[model samples]
Target: MMRRLYQSLMAASRAHAQWEIETTTNIIKNRKMLIILLLMALPLIIPAMVHAASLPEAIGGKAAYGPSYFSAKMFYGSIAIGVVAGLVTGCIGAGGGFLITPALMSLGVKGILSVGTDMFHIFAKAIMGTTLHKKMGNVNVGLAVAFLVGSGLGVTGGGIINRALYNYNPVMSDFTISMIYAVLLGFLGFFALSDYFKVRKSELSKNKIGLEKLTPMAERMQSVNLAPMIQFDEKIVPGGRKISGVFVAISGAITGLLAAILGVGGGFVTFPMFVYGLGISTYTTVGTDILQIIFTAGYGAIAQYALYGYIFYTLAMGCLLGSLLGVQIGAITTKVVSQSKIKAFYAIAILAGFINRIFALPEKLSQMGYISLTPSTGAILTNIGVWVFFGLVAIFAVWIIGTFIVNVPNLRAEYDEGSKAEYNAEYGEDNKAVVSTKRGAAQ
Candidate 1:
């Protein structure tokens, strides 16, 4: 059962990752839209850059920092984080967004700032990527609308709780955030490791690809015929599946609250919930997850974090730029590596994050006077956690880049062959010579 759950989660992650790639590609292809987005962003980014160093030390009697809050080191540091995250997302097809908050927190960023900046980054990415999915006829309008309705309320409530905690005490806020990360990462990391080991053992004997079966929970949920059933994705699944709208809303609410508090896009959680909890088809879930991310992250960032003056524009932009490049590289590298290897790395990466957060929790608890510890002990433990987290992430990044470089020749050849085949299929053998001549002339 646990193994099945792990497989389901991985499936969802891959679906979400594909959606992310498509969305990003679409935005890049549309030059006019890209220009408009940049123009809109400049107003917020420029002023933040100018006044970051001298902005007020506090807002509404709470400690706050401006967009320029980061030094040159921090700016570059954020980019590095983004690149690794994108690589993880592109290569593994999930788990990239999971790294952002933990990475930022490890770098000495404030909890609220990390959450806010992460949300802003997600919102920006969503804005650019969502158009492609809509045009591709992937989204189910009714499903998306119902999910967003619940997500909106959940995010709003979560934002309020996060702010209230921060306003009451920074120590409490940090503690709360750290605790959340520790618990979540720990749970996920455990299952991922188990799945990895299980797969390794199975591969040694069976040496075959296995199909994933839906969980009993999903079967039961799909059977429920509560009123106002949402009929969706009939094009993909004959007759489609219907469940009580309340269940969908509840799932959305859970996803939204987690997104708001953790500063993740929540697709990681959303995917599994839609599939394993609600029994939605992977195709429908991916499309809907893409649609919901825009609304959930945007509202959470603007209303919850930005309005409270917790966002760091520079950090968000730095991450945005770095991730775009990283994702491209990671996606290309995926062609070279085996699926089992990829899954192993995913498990390791998640476990590394889990350990990082778990270690950080002690210091937060000590600070809040919930536990007692010597200052030196706390500092040493914190330092150890930071080093371990970055060390693992850095190793993973290096491995991916090295693998890509070594296989570049093969990848390029594959690309050329595929391109030629596609061109031949489109223009036919008779037109191939003429097309080649025209292409060279244009060049």
Candidate 2:
């Protein structure tokens, strides 16, 4: 089950990465869209510059890092964070967005701010990238409507909870977020590490991979004949299947709640839930997930976070900029790197985040008076975790960049050779028409 879950999550991550690439490329190409984004951002950035809050003023806590104002330092630092996250997603192909919130907290940004900022960044990307007409054929309108109905409710509830906690005590809010991250990261990290070893062993033994089996729960859910059923998978499956609308909505609620709180767009679990929980076909699930993610992230970020002033616009933009470059480079680098090394690095990166979150928890607890540890001791442990997490990520980034640099010549040669082969295959080796067309275009 853990292995299956890991595979589902990885699949979802790949989908999200593809969306990022497409949207970012379009944003670059469409100057009108780029101008609109910049225009929208200026309002947020200019106001923030004039009315930036100090740490204490923002959160009613001690100003540990001084005023929480925008600066070049913060901008560049956020860019670096985004770059590492994008590299992880592009190269390792899973669990990259998991780093953003934790990394932000380590940099002294409040947890709520981190979560909200990440959500906004995702929302912006989704809006720019959405090409709904192409995907409409695979999307079940009824099913999507039901899910969004539940998701909207869930987002409202989650937003209220986060705000209430912040109102009660900022430290308490940070503590809650930290604890949630620690538990989640720890669970996923262990499973990822186990998967790495399994893959390594399989490679050494030269074993063939097998298809995934469906769980009994999925079969049972699909068989349920409850009223108001949502029908789907008509194009692929013979006659398709029907499941209760209540079931689908409940799944959406759960996904939306998590997205609202964690700012992950809930993509991590949507694929698994649709396929394993509701027994939906992967073909239908992919299209639905994409549509749902756009709505979920946008609604959560705008109605919940942005309205509440939890978003950091400058940081979000910086992250977006950095991630675009990082993802392009990382995706290209994947051609040269070994699969085993990528898997190993993915495990290490997740564990590093888990360690960082878990270690930081003690300090938050101390601040909230839930523990009796000395401040200095807690700070030391927190710093250690922060350094460890960032150091591992930085090292990984350096290695990826270095590998790309070292193998540029070889990569270029392979690309040219592949292009030539493709052209030859298409036009034949002695096709003068194709040669003339290429020359004409160049001229």
Candidate 3:
């Protein structure tokens, strides 16, 4: 009798599922033609929508060094760059380091000072970003907390040492840290680009040849004996799996160092590390990364930007307003481009930043007389060309934003592919509550 009842329940569920499937099919059939048109139109329309957002003149004033407020152009300039930087940072799934740091450089912002300012804005933006991600139910609290505690201490220790050095000898502290940071970032960029190419070459080989391709780095990461493991509860590809604590610590430490020195949020490295290094499913990594950033970068933002007197109200506010909207559009773009494609594009964008900095070396050396800034009649022409190269970064940034808005409709079809639907469904409307529970459990 009990077995018959169980069978009857199964049959009823099958019928209901069949009915839903039939209805879904009909709806899809009717909308197929209309959907195609919408796809072609969205990419174009999104930019126009964004352009309509005009921030207050007071909020976005010029970026300058003074006791007085900034000019309007400077304000708008910073806002524009910050918004674009935030969008790209959020888009590539990396910390926005490669984008934001260079933006300050473009403005001829002084070192350490600019680093502090950029960090302040990054912290503000990260808070905004993670807040939105949480609302969508995409955050993983346990991993974020683990990352924060370990990352925080290392950053604090580094800061203490830096301050001590600067106080003892002004010349040594300022020059040494800045140069070290620049060299380190350049090195990391090369390492990151190298690995990206390796992964791509492997993929191309798999597609072109009969050879079985393997991702050895990924395999090695999985083999490590890191302890204090925790389950994400969300399945990435399929059946849920767990990840260890130690890898999380390592990724966090790297992020903190970058955050402190360069004043970047390190979201770029952190998100990829979580997804690839610690093996957290893609579903949980964004939220986890954001959560960690909120604290880690926030610390730097406060200590460096606000506490150090680099907080430009108008510039920060303009950045906040424009970036808020830009980030939304950027989030939307994730739908149109596939994850692999986005990562590739992002790697390209980062490569561009490295190229810009690398080529700027002549300008830097000449300013210090390490190289010649003096010009023959023709040398002026070469200097002009070098200045033009600097403008490539600015032009490239404009092109990215313009293209993002212009292509929205064309990529509309791809938008929903990476949506965090499971998270939204599971947590309902209370993601923070759900995350708190997870953190407590992990601890």
Sorted on TM-score, best first, the list reads 2, 1, 3
Candidate 2 residue lDDT tens string, 295-353: 88899889998997888888888777777777777888999998888878888888899
Which is the winner by TM-score between candidate 1 and candidate 2?
A: 2
lDDT of each: 0.78, 0.79, 0.51
lDDT for each residue of candidate 1 in 297-367, tens digit (9 for 90 to 100):
99999999998788877788778867876788889898999877877887788888888888887877787
Residue 283 CA displacement from its true place in model 2, Å: 1.3
Question: How well does candidate 3 match the true structure, expressed as C-alpha RMSD?
Answer: 16.7
Clashing pairs in 2: none
Better of 1 and 3 by TM-score: 1
- Candidate 2, residue 276: CA error in Å? 0.8
Q: Residue 113's C-alpha lDDT in candidate 3? A: 48
- Clash statistics: count for each candidate: 1, 0, 20
Model 3 lDDT tens row, 17-133 = 222222223333446633653464355344434444443544432222232333345556666766665455445434334455555444444445455666676565444333343
* TM-score of each prediction: 0.85, 0.87, 0.55
RMSD of each: 4.9, 4.4, 16.7
Estimate the overall C-alpha local distance difference test score of candidate 1.
Answer: 0.78
Cα error, candidate 1, residue 282 (Å): 2.0
Shift in Å, residue 95, candidate 3: 7.4
